[model samples]
Target: MRVSGLILPWAFLLATALFAVGLYWALWVAPPDFRQGDGARIMFVHVPAAALSIGVYAVMAAASVTALIWRHPVSDLTAKSCAPVGAAFTLIALITGSIWGKPMWGAWWVWDARLTAELILLFFYLGYMALWNAVEDQTTAARAAAILCCVGSVSALLSKYSVNFWNTLHQPASLSVDKAEHVHDAFYLPLLVMMGAFYAYFMAFLLLGVRKEIRARRIRNLRGALAREAGA
Candidate 1:
């Protein structure tokens, strides 16, 4: 908590700075796509949000695995904290993708493979969080939620590979590890900056969320103890 308190402000500041630079670069500095024109600018927001939606779920799944196997004290909290954040990112990705899609695809949405997979991922996040609330015992809730998260890992995988596995309206990744020349410098650099800003924002939000979960757990424990004492 103490360490997070010190780092949170810096994380927020960094995210703010990067967002300002990234938006300016993406909106003004980068050339409008000959094909999409200014509409392409939406990718500046959509791409990062889409990436983080999957990335954050991956983090939650990893934490869930750790919590289930090792029973690490903070691992469950970390997974729980990631749920709403991941869901928010997924929602942003969906909305932005639809907005970008309208101009390109002639519709606000389609049942494309990648889009369907992403929607499923959002459902997984919702179900995982719902499982936590449905169970009364904290231990049971954590175990169930962890299992759900691990099982939901398949959705994340599908989301990443759906474009490759099937023909879809959604385009393949703009950047790639194997492909050196994916996008031009102007678009690539600003996209990178935006991704960094989103990551920094995630870190700040995650830290704050974990701290809140810890405090809530502590209060629950105290209340349980008080009830036991009263019963005795």
Candidate 2:
């Protein structure tokens, strides 16, 4: 393999361990929210998922750029590999956000900036996948999808900042990028664990998906070569 194969398995193991630690801290060690009580526990997963959705989108964008710039087959495969995972993360974020909203905001859905932008992102993902399927040629499909991926990345950025750019039902960022706070070390430690777990999950899935795509491509090449030899 051109990539670090060992890293994926190690990442999977590390992620599992982190997830276990995070769950323990969130459920047992960290104190419940003064306001939301036990319900606040949901944030442990929701926030991480939401953040990851955006982060993965950024990765997809970078991969798309590489695919177009370097014309690297692996880059295209990696970009294509990320779509489903990104979509899954986005779905998880939306569902958890809705659930959190119902208890906190008294509504299941809203046309707020963040929510609207996120929904648009979901559509963009679907559209990009559809475009890939519509094209018959792999090169053509990769180019088209790369464009769509790059263009669609705008929505991903907007999704992250929508809460701040406009008034929205979604809460602002949990940990400020600008300022630091004395978050209870217990809570911070677990938050790190969960974040690491989520990242590992992304890597595990992305690597597996790319590996499958590479295998299929190799098979196609072999079949084409055999057919050519027979014809000759």
Candidate 3:
């Protein structure tokens, strides 16, 4: 808690700085694409949100695995905290993708493989959170949620690889480590900065959420102890 408290402010500051620079570069500094014109600028926000939507789920799934297998003290809390944030990112990705698609694809949406898979991923996130809320017992809820997270991880895999496995209107990755030349530096650098900002925002939000969960659990435990003493 102490370490997280100290680090949280810096994380927010870093995210803020990166977001300011990234948005400036993406919106103003980067040249309009010859092909898509200014419509392509939306990719700067859309791409990062799309990537993080899956990436955050991966983090939750890993934490869920640890919570289930090793019973790590903070693992379940970490996974629980990740769900809402991941869901928000998924929603952003969907909305932004739709916005970008309408102009480029000439429709608001299509049943593209990647888009369908991403929608399923959003459902998984909602189900995971719903399970946590439905169960009364914390331990039982944690176990059930962890299992769901693991099972739903298949959606994340599908979301990532659907473009590769099937024909789709959605384009391939805008940036790749091996194929750096595919995107011009003007666009690529700003995209990278935006991704960094999103990641930093995730970390800051995750820490804040986990801390809140820990405090809530402590309060519940204390109240339980008080009730037991009164009954005795």
Candidate 4:
């Protein structure tokens, strides 16, 4: 755990550097879309935000499984810490998509399947966080939250496939490793860089959040023990 103390600072610095350069490359270095023009610039942010929102949930679901099966002390904390970050990225995805949509789709939002499913994903995040805090008992709360996280994890798959399942205002994925990338090199390169930066940011912050939760738990236990001793 002491290694985490040393690791977080360097991780934060690396994330910052990557983001700074990635954003610059995305905005300035990458050429605009041949069709959408500068409006396509929003893709650099929207795609990563959307991906990480589901990606973080995937991490949470894995932690949830560990917490349920192995009963690891930190698993619940890891899952709990991920909700807000996932929610924030979900929000960024929604808002950026809306902004990009206004220019392309002539509207800020539509009731299309992918958009609707993403909205549902937001509720799942909010619900998960609320569920954890609403309970007073830590152990009970963690178990409850873990179950909810596991069940709701399906929404991530639904969100990802929604675009593929229906013909909607949203377009299909532009990049795929198995298939030829739809984007040109000018745009694809920067998008790849940005995605890497976004993932780095998530990992760095996630570790920091988990570390804070661990510290907070220890402090609470210490204070409770002191009170019990004084009473005795």
Candidate 5:
């Protein structure tokens, strides 16, 4: 916990630095795409948000699994906390994707496979959170919510592969092949920096969420003990 606490400040600072440098580079230093022109700048933020949206769901699902199978209260709290974060990231991805889509696809939205799957993924996040809130008993809610998370993981997978598996206006991943990013030399650095920033941002948020959930659980336990004492 102490290690994670120390990492938090570094993560936030790194994310801020990367974002500052990356955005400046993306906006000014990077040349316009021959095809997409300046509109491609959206990818800098949109791709990170989209990628992390899927990534966050995986975190939620895994934590959900541990919460259910092992009855780990911390896992349950972590899973529940991640829902809002994932939802927020998903919303960012959708809005930016839509902005990019308007000029490129000639429409603000389309029935493309990737787009459709991502939309469903967002719905899943919302549903998971709603389910958690609807239940009053924490144990029951955790179990029920975990089931939903595990089930909805299918949508997350579909979203990740929709671009490769089907015909879509959404372009293939730019960061393929690790060393060789299919983009121009200028765009690659900024894109990579943005990706790093996004990753750091995710880690920082995850730590915060875990810490918050842990504290909340502690408070609840204390209150429960107090109630028992008062009754005695």
Candidate 6:
């Protein structure tokens, strides 16, 4: 718990530093894309959000598994905390991807493998949230929602491989062997910094959400205790 307590403040500091460096690199240093021109700046946010959206789901799913296997309350709360944040990130990815695509691809939307699978991933997050809220019993909610999370992981996997599996407007992997240095040095550095910032942001938010949930639980317990005392 002591180690975990340190994560919040450190995450906040890390996020700030990364975001500052990343913005400088992305906006000032990176040259305009020959093809996309200034519009390609969208990649910094779009790629990181898209990548982290998938990663957050993985975290939720893993926490769900731990909750069920170890019967840990903190694990359940952490899983619950992650779902909404993951959903928000997924939405950001979709929106930014559309914005990035319109001028470049000449279309705002496409039913390609990557897009479709990512859409499905969003729905999965929503469904998990709904399931958790629908149940009145905490234990039952955690167990049932955990199962959904595990099942929905299939789509997450599909999302990762979708570009490879099918011809899509979305470009191939950023780190492909064929295109080791596809992006300019200036852009690459900032993009990496942005990615680090996004990760730190995710951690900070995760811990914040967990703390809020814990406090809510504590308040509920106190309320229950007061009611018992009043009855006595």
Ranking by lDDT: 3, 1, 4, 6, 5, 2
- How many clashes does the backbone of model 2 have? 0
TM-score of 1: 0.96
Model 3 per-residue lDDT tens digits across residues 92-153: 99999999999899998998989998999999999999999999999999999999999999
Task: State how far residue 95 of model 1 sits from its true place (Å).
Answer: 0.4
- Write the residue-wise lDDT of candidate 1 on 31-63 in tens digits: 998888889899999999999999999999999
Among the numbered candidates, top lDDT falls to: 3
Q: Answer with 2 or 3, whichever has the higher lDDT.
A: 3
| Whole-model lDDT, model 3 | 0.94
Give one digit per residue, the lDDT tens place, for model 2 in 88-173: 88888889889988989999998888998888888887887788789988899999999999999889989988977987767778
Model 3 clash pairs are: none
Model 2 ranges with Cα > 4 A deviation: 178-186
91-182, model 5: which lDDT tens digit per residue? Answer: 99999999999999899998888889999999999999999889988779889999999999999999999888988888887776756647
Q: lDDT (CA) for every model shown?
A: 0.94, 0.84, 0.94, 0.89, 0.88, 0.88
After superposition, the stretches of candidate 6 with alpha carbons farther than 4 Å from their true spots are: 1-5, 176-182
List runs of model 1 lying over 4 Å from the truth. 179-181
Better of 3 and 4 by TM-score: 3
Give candidate 2's error at residue 17 in angstroms.
Answer: 1.0
Error of 2 at 186 (Å): 4.5
Q: Alpha-carbon error at 181 in model 1, in Å?
A: 4.4
Residue 192: error of model 4 in Å?
1.2
